[model samples]
Target: MSSVKETVDVAAPLRIAYNQWTQFEEFPLFMEGVDEVRQLDDRHNHWTTSIGGVRREFDTEIVDQLPDDRITWRSVAGDTRQRGSVRFERIDETHTRVELTMDVEPTGIAEKGADALGVIDRRVKGDLSRFKDYLESRGHESGGWRGRIRPADPGSPL
Candidate 1:
């Protein structure tokens, strides 16, 4: 498994940053190689992405989530094997630090090569940079999901 962590300070409140992260459907706007994201439900999401010329599709389940704090998920069913979490920390009233930590198991030559070459890291960095710009420019989240999801009841949203 290859691990990558990236962080960026956005000029937005903690809620604004956290809310925008919850908007999974809008990920393609800032995430590179992500073609589409569909919120299957409050705790499930379907994703289509092409990375390093390899096209892949996956379904991820939100294992744990706390509004304005963090969200963690893992690929439950798909050709992809990955898990990650995003956390938000308030630096001040107008600044929030967004952090992303991901663990990915690359399958096939293309994916492995990209990971070994740090392509994934660069991509993640670029994604975070874009996210910072996107949220700062908007100055607000497009929408938010304040409900929490606990590991004990993964599908039952709270």
Candidate 2:
């Protein structure tokens, strides 16, 4: 598995930054290589992505989530094998630090080679940078889901 971690400081307030991130369907606007994201439910999302001419469709389930703090997810059923988390930290009233960490298993030789070359790491960093710009320019979130999903208790919404 190849692990990638990246961080970016956004100009928006913590709440604004966190809220905008919950708008999963809007990810294509800022996330490169992501063609579409459909929120199946509060804890599930379907994603379509084309990276390096490789197209993939995946379904991810949110394993844990806390409003304004963090969101963690794993691929439940898909062509991709990965898990990741995005955490939000308040730097100040008008700024938020977003950290993303992901672990991806390369399926084939091409993917493994790209991972070794730091292609995925660079893409993740670029995505975060674009996210910063997207939120800063908008000045407000498109939408937000404040619901919680705890890994220990799937049926309970905390």
Candidate 3:
């Protein structure tokens, strides 16, 4: 497994930053290679992505979610095996810091080679940078889901 960690500071409040992050369907706008994300429910999502010329689909289940703080998820079933978390920190009343950490398992030669060449790390960083641009440009979130998902509630709905 390979891991990538990246951080970015956005000119928005913690609530705005965190709220934007919850709209998974908008990820394709800022997240490179993410073709589409369907939020099946509050704690479930289906992702379709094309990375390094390879297209894949995956389903993820949110393991834990804390409003305006952090959200964690792991792939439940799909063509990829991975897990990740996003954390939100308040820098000030109008500034926020967002951090992302992900663990990915590369399958086949192409993916393994890309991971070995630090492509994944660069991608993560670029994605976060774009996210900063996206939120900063809008000056607010398009919409938000502030609901909490506890570890004990795996099938929670939005």
Candidate 4:
């Protein structure tokens, strides 16, 4: 499997960074390829993505999640296969570092060719930058999961 990872430091607390991400349904607000996300279960989600006019849908299972630390997932079934993790590190009481690592195999030869040529990296980086900007602009998480479809409770904040 091939991989691409990127990191960014945010001027926000770790909980702030983490809670925002835990709300996966909000991803389309920052992610470009994401058209929609529906929580299927606490650890499962369905996502729709579109890039360069090609649209695909996939279901992924959250392999692991540790609040204020990391969230990992891999495609359970889809047109394309992918696996990735987003890790959050508390740099200080008010600063956090976000790292993303993703390995993806395109479903078609055209998408594979584009990946070999660096298009995918650009898209990934752009998405991260957007997330950074959006998070910073918001200054706080908009809200959190209210749907009962989630597998586990968020529990009380520490």
Alpha-carbon runs more than 4 Å astray in model 1: 153-158
As for candidate 3, its clashing pairs are none
lDDT of candidate 1 over 1-158, digit per residue (tens): 99999999999999889999999999999999999999999999999999767799999999899999999999999999999999999999999999999999999988898899999889989999999999999978999999989787556652
Local accuracy of candidate 2 as per-residue lDDT tens digits, 38-147: 99999999999998889999999999999999999999898999999999999999999999999999887888999999999999999999999999988899988899
On the 0 to 100 scale, the lDDT of residue 157 in model 3 is 52
Clashing residue pairs in candidate 4 (N, C-alpha, C atoms within 3 angstroms): 42-151
Selected candidate, larger TM-score, 3 vs 4:
3
Q: What is the C-alpha RMSD of each candidate to the true structure, in Å?
A: 2.8, 2.7, 3.0, 5.8
lDDT of each: 0.93, 0.94, 0.94, 0.83
Q: Cα deviation of 106 in candidate 1 (Å)?
A: 0.5
Off by over 4 Å in 2: 153-158
Q: What is the TM-score of each candidate against the true structure?
A: 0.95, 0.95, 0.95, 0.88
Candidate 3 per-residue lDDT, tens place, 1-158, comes to: 99999999999999999999999999999999999999999999999999988999999999889999999999999999999999999999999999999999999999999999999999999999999999999988999999988776456652
